[model samples]
Structure formats: C-alpha cells, structure tokens
Target: MQGQNGRGTDMPPAVSVRLEVIKRRSDFLKAARAQRRGMPGFLLQARRRASDEPDPSAIRVGFTCSRKVGNAVTRNRAKRRLRALAREILPQLGRPGWDYVLVGRPGATVTRDFAAMREDLIRALRRIHESPQ
Candidate 1:
C-alpha cells in the first residue's frame, strides 16, 4: 500500500514497537510536576527519571482525560486518540528514562483533526526536550 506521502517504498512496516506503560498514580503525579508543554489538543508532561531508577533504558508513558472533556464515552475517546498519538510518535522521538503523560484537553482533544493532533504531539515533545530544565 502507498503511504500518505505517496511513496510506496517509503512506507514503514507494521512491526510492533514496544514502550513501557506508566501505570501507577504516583508516577503520573510525578510527571505532572515536571516539565509540561501545552498544545492545542493536549498537554504533554515529561519527567526524566534519575540515573538510579530501575529500567533506566525504558521510555514510559501515561494517558488521561478529565471529566471536563465530557462524559465517559467522550473522555475515553479522547484518551484513545492520545494513545494512538503516543504510539505513532513516542517510540522514535521520546527519550529513554523519561515518563510522559498525555492529558487530553476539553473540546479540542475530540474535535481536532487526527493529522493535526499528531503534529501537536510531535511539536510538544520537541519543545519539552529543547527547553532548559
């Protein structure tokens, strides 16, 4: 199949790329207090784990959508979009030993275009990495 860029050979394979999931509430809260970059669709919170932490080579991430986003169905939809965005962009661009939380924004998270949402995530990650701590 041809890629979105219209280059048949330029498309990447469907190989699964694995990334560690941040499941604990404390981890997400820690990342929340770290550096954050806000985009149109979501807020990207990133925290670089200390050298002494276990799994120093793993990149971990979390997804969340608040009630302000909508009802359960809408919030879940927003989280799903954020998850897809992370899956597509984080493996290559996210730095190891860092935890990232993608928090969905009200209205924008569900209404924004998918390609634009992807770009928002990419830009937010870039800003987070480039900014001085």
Candidate 2:
C-alpha cells in the first residue's frame, strides 16, 4: 500500500526514506524499561546499542525478528517492512525530542498487512506522544 505525501501518490524505497538514528547504550535500556510502563500497545524495545541518556532531538528506532519469524531472508524482509513503516509514520507522530524503536514479532510483523503495519506504527506513536511526560 501507499501513503499520501500530498502533491501525488509516491512510493519511496523503504530503504531510501528510512532514517537511521543510532541508540545510545543507556538510553536504549531506559526505553526498554519504559516499555513496561507504557499503556496498552505502546511497549518499547531496543534494536541497537543502549546509551546513558536519550537523544534530545532524535527519534531513536530499532527493528527485530526472532528465529520463529523465519529464516534470515524472512527476518530481513520483516525488518525492511518495519523500517519503511517508520520512515513514513515516525516523522508524523514523533515529537521533536523523542526516540523511537521498532521491535519485530515472529510472525506478527512479517506476515501482517503492510497497510495495517503502517497504521499500527502510527497508532503506537500517537500513544507515545499522547502519553504522560
């Protein structure tokens, strides 16, 4: 499926549009813990390094897929899909000074609807943004 980017309907390569903001060592863990504190459907996880502090201006993101998801190829495909979802929806729901991490579920992310995946990420981000600070 395609997202409305105004002017016209466009399909940017998920890789081309994806922004890679590395997570620091400590911050990653903090958010992971924050996941437990999150309300329904807003848990967080880490896909990269953890930092001492969260980045004030970057929306840190991560991707993951367990062995159950599939073989290497399937895992990669799931990651690519999540990366694309983040690319399109992150900037919209993300706050200027927040971080985002995308964690993949075995079959949930890999076999799910791409459009629904897009909506899920959007809803998650919205929950994060609307959550208490």
Candidates in order have lDDT scores of: 0.86, 0.57
Q: Which tens-of-lDDT digit does each residue in 1-133 have in candidate 2?
A: 3445551224332333235564475655555666422222223442322344454445567655568778999889877887777777665555544555666676677777776665566556555556565
**Candidate 2 Cα misplacement greater than 4 A, ranges:** 1-18, 23-26, 36-55
User: Tens-digit lDDT track for model 1 on 10-70?
Assistant: 3344335478888999999999999999999999999999889889988899999989999
Q: How far is each candidate from the true structure, as Cα RMSD in Å?
A: 3.3, 5.8
Please report the TM-score between candidate 1 and the true structure. Answer: 0.87
Please tell me which predicted candidate would have the highest lDDT against the true structure.
Answer: 1
lDDT of 1 at 75: 99
Cα shift from native, residue 127, model 2 (Å): 1.4
- Which residue pairs collide in model 1, if any? none
**What does candidate 2 score in Cα RMSD to the true structure?**
5.8
